[model samples]
Target: MTDTTTARKPPTSKNSEVHVKKRRLPDETGIFIVLVAVLLVFSILSPNFRTIDNGFTLLVNGTVIGFLALGQTFVLLTGGIDLSTGANIAMSGVLVALVMQAGVPWPAAMLIALIAATSLGVLNGLLIHYVRIPPFIATFSTQGVALAIPLIITGANSIQVRDIGFSWIGQGRIAGVPLPVLLLLVAAVIAGLWLRMTRQGVHVYALGGNKNAARLAGVNIARTTILVYAISGFCGGMGGMIVTSRLMVGFPATGTGNELFYSIAAAVVGGISLFGGVGTVLGAMIGAVLIAAVSNGMNVLSVQSYWQSLVIGVIILVGVSFDTLRRSRAGRPVFAKRPAVDTPSLPPSTTPSKS
Candidate 1:
């Protein structure tokens, strides 16, 4: 009698094994290189883009997006997103301008706008945390409300800002640096430090990483959620102030434009994961600068606005895909997997022949 086995194993040959190349550089390194390459390419293609003044213009123009992306980084770190930020810009911009026109002092009006925006964020938090509404739906609903508020109040007309001091916020320079740019830098620095060194920041990360685990570890879910959204709102309000200051006008349609989309794209492109809990302020800011550069370069080259949108959309797709792949490969072994080879077993001999 003979025994036989039916098991077969995958081949162990080098060809049979899949090979995943080791990452030669950190994730941020690739995006940083891409940014440099983009700058170089545009500088080579457009002489106008190589000028110092144009560089400053790009930085100024990116301020709103940078602010939105900065706030976005906070919400994303907590595994949430705030779609209402763009609308917050519209709401706050129009609100500030309207109140200023209504005899409120410019400084006071600015305070009111920031408060309104923060209140909007708080509403979103309450809905998401208390009512159990999903972050997406809650923010989307708030976005609509915010978008409509400015239009209803202004009748879709642009409000002219008469306060010259307001211009200082957007147009003034300190040591040849635009105030808005400087403001964004200061905010980014503070945000980065808070996230790295603060206990609350750790709570935000834990919440995003795993809600249950974080809860078990005593993270205050409601406070973290509300706080992140509120911070996002504050950032949105700052963006609103800058927009209003820059043009000396509050356009209701400003928020309805590509600002929201670009802000999200900047965060993702900068390496903020769509799934959350895995990104940095520096990366997001770099992503913002990259998007700004692309936008400025396109304008310099006279590329159509629609084409710019297409390029940004492509960037978003690529960034999300990269993030997804990274997550999937998180725990994978360093080398490609291989299995031992197996040979078939012989059948048993006939008992009659043996007898």
Candidate 2:
């Protein structure tokens, strides 16, 4: 009775604690190395490729795809893909131009364009979450609709944009930096902070890592998914507006197939997992720059457009292959053998020899 209230501890020893080594997760380091190598190769191939003017052109062209890739990163983090991003860009640009042409104020037209783009995202989310459609099929179907809307609206022709103020967003430069490139930088910084420092960002990673586990852990899957797609749409819309400003017209076929290819390729080549739960906006931006560099290098070297396309396709394949291999390696056991355990024998029980 005297010791009844005392807690009895179980056996403890130095060997009781077992240390486990975690396998290092794959990251963008390899991609960065590849980017450096590509840069070196290109720089050596053509003197013009290393020129400051060419560098600026690369950045300017990369900005549009960079924004699209940034948005794609959000969707990819949630284990989803948005095939409709290109179409959303086209439709938003067309709508904005039409509204502006109708004598609407630039600010209001911009807002309307953004809303229209985001609305497509909402519709995509609803189809996936509510109707239980697969992400690819859902987005693919909507892609057709998005592409059609612009064609119908503009009768398949480019619409002129007369708004001088709107043009400044894409054309104006500050401190000798292109406005579009500056916008891309700002967007990348904000997106990077949000994804790395916020709770919702953690949820996104968790959801992508294991959707069932995330749901069990109380992550709001529907809301997160919807938000991700909406972000993608917003980015696509911004890209469209920039392009429209640069061209001084809203081309119904502006983005078309190229947008989808560039956005997805940039994200993948930047080390973002096609399976999701991994990647960084900074890597995506670097990937965009790499792509632009390749294109510029090819142009400087007088490579044919078809050859450029082939090279890009090969790059995409190589990046995806690396990603698949990385994932497969992650699934293997990090430590092949378990730590050995030592157990001490109990002292002979003298009382048991009562016989």
lDDT of 2: 0.82
Local accuracy of candidate 2 as per-residue lDDT tens digits, 1-355? 5879788998765454432234455466656666788889999888888888888888888888898899899898778999998998899899999999999988899999999898888888889888999999999999999999989978899999998999887888899989899999999999999888998988777777777767766788899889898899898899888888888898899889677888998998886767777778888888888777777788889988778768877776665566556656767422121111122344697446655
Cα-based TM-score, every candidate: 0.84, 0.83
For model 1, residues 294-347, the per-residue Cα lDDT tens digits are 999999999988899888777656655655465457653322111111223445
Off by over 4 Å in 1: 1-26, 316-355
Residue 177, candidate 1: Cα error in Å is: 0.3
Off by more than 4 A, model 2: 1-26, 318-355
